[model samples]
Target: MNLQYKTIVVTGGGSGMGRELVIALLKKGAKVAAIDINKDSLEETVRIAGDYGINASTFVLDITDKSAVEETVKEMLVRLKSIDGLINNAGIIQPFAAVNDLDDKTTERVMNVNFWGTYYLTKTILPHLLTRPEAHIVNVSSMGGFIPFPTQTIYGASKAAVKILTEGLYAELKNTAVNVTVVHPGAIMTNITQNSGLGGPKVDNNDKNNMALSPSKAAQIIIRAMEKNKFRATVGKDAWFLDKLYRLAPKFATNFIGKMMKKSLAQH
Candidate 1:
């Protein structure tokens, strides 16, 4: 779908790739409703967006809150006239731990923000998106979506679900003008880890091989993929290589990742 003149909603727009995406969208002459749970960050995003134009709007919302999300959608339609596209980019990463090692609440929180939040926003805006002549839904999964990474079991599971859920949406809407794009981002330096404040030891800071892409680069790649209406995209060499490996050797590939997780856990 052409972004020009369309209204796009980007969750997690306060920072990271989402904020950059809002800037990119504005350059294409699209109206943007940038949402985040962090109101302070939202203000900062909107302030920075001033150079972009008046078309940028901010909505403070917790995507997992059903009533809040529903209400926000209603208000957005009334305010912006229409929601032409949605980028389900709000997500949190669980610290490395075996599923059983993570507390029940911890696992649920990860799933809620990473998977259910995406699902809620998609379901809420779907009706409004369908009303438009052309609509797009960009679901940001992760390399973990395609390949299981140790300790990140919940994070990986949620992304994997998003991968399949987004594909299902794409398949279901194939005949329509609406488009769905799923992204598998390799490790990029961003606050999905820091901001989440999830428990357990963090991933090693020196995993240079995996942390190849920057948020800005990731945002650009995402926009390009959405423009092509690509069904799936893998960002960064780490992510790209992982996707290929996952497809060619699912068992061994995951095993390697599992070992990495174990090492990280042992270090912690």
Candidate 2:
């Protein structure tokens, strides 16, 4: 869990939080294998990690392709020598629309990347992780995973599945050497919408000041969580507040969130 001298695999490491995590892990002296579909962004990540010397490498692969994932992880292990951790940060958002208005293909893609993608990698790497003395697994769920959000229902559902899956893994690994941590991040400034192939809204001028967290900060928090072997961590104020609110008053929390998202929902 110290991360130092350990080897970790991070999905979606081309940019955003995933890239930040690669940088952070390298700083901690961990060997990293950064995976993403974008070779250019992955190259950029490795460039930034140059100061860390040969402790980092990049892999270009689609997580949703189970066969590709299996093959890639096998090759990744050869490059990294050994794997001590797996962070599933690769995911996509659904088009902004209600479930009734959403297309089947989009729905499937969302679930495939967000949920099954995580599953595929986890399944492939778990046995190797078990062989290690200690290892960590970090899964990025979202505030929307536990809190309902208009126009993001399918995206939320996919993340929700991840939330439960991580929790279940934690339970199963209670007495094992591997540790599991689920993360719920809120309003981190990232190009997720653009990467997901959905044009995002122009940033509200107010949003520049009001956003809850940054990818670097989130990466720091996640690394801390891994070091501490925490069961769960919420990355931003909004995520923490919503998590508490939903647990205390699900109906009221849903209504409140719906009200806040009314404008965006209308556009959808």
Candidate 3:
């Protein structure tokens, strides 16, 4: 699962952890096809990837756009000549509003990008990836995926679905050349929360997890997981411990998370 000299396709690679991954992969001499809706951010990613002679390039396409996803990946395969791995990082987090408050557009937008987008790209690339002797699919699920947070129930549900989807892929691909890995990221400093409207009173933020690792650090963890072909990797101590607690007592864990969310949502 070495990333060096391999071709990797990363969704949402224009910013945050996805962008960090593109930088790291390029450093390892991998030819990366970075995808994002923001062409400007994607260009910024390439500028930082100067180590690879700027070999990394961006594809401006919305992951939730099915036709665009298919066409984009096809073009990537044509240009790179191979698909070694895919990191599904493109996602949207709407306002931290209750389900009743959440509008149809927001709900559908989140589901379409976070869940369906992952599915569309995975399905389109699985066959091509399977053709390679050793390929990987890294699905970026979240700590939220493991433990439900108030106002984020639907978002969590979408991520949780991604977790199961990854597991299913692993189950069916057993003994096959391809590897499926699920990543649960801890609280990290990224534009995702702020840009996607996850902050403010809409969602809780009282207990700011400052032990929060940066996207670059998280990217390193993910790269390590790929090196070991880890079936699952939890990004920080917080996310790991919380995941265990979740398995032990989902009922209690749910209540605890609710409190945390409430705290974060404290008067700002």
For model 3, how does the per-residue alpha-carbon lDDT over 168-241 read when each residue is reduced to its tens digit?
Answer: 99999988999999999988767786657556422232346456777889999998898789999999888998
User: Which is better, 1 or 3, measured by TM-score?
Assistant: 3
Each candidate: how many clashes? 1, 0, 5
lDDT of 2 at 189: 74
**Root-mean-square deviation (CA) per prediction:** 2.6, 1.9, 2.9
Candidate that beats the other on TM-score, 2 or 3, i.e. the better one: 2
lDDT, candidate 2, 1-268, per-residue tens: 8889999999999998999999999999898999999999999988877777478888999899999999998898777778999999998898778899998999999999999999999999999999999999999999989999988999999999999999999999999999999999998877788889988664342465556577889899999999999999999889999999999999999999988889756656
Residue pairs with clashing backbones, model 1 = 97-151
Candidate 3: clashing residue pairs, number: 5
lDDT by candidate, in order shown: 0.88, 0.91, 0.86
Candidate 1's clash total is 1
- Model 3 worst lDDT window (10 residues): 200-209
Better of 1 and 3 by lDDT: 1
Best by TM-score: 2
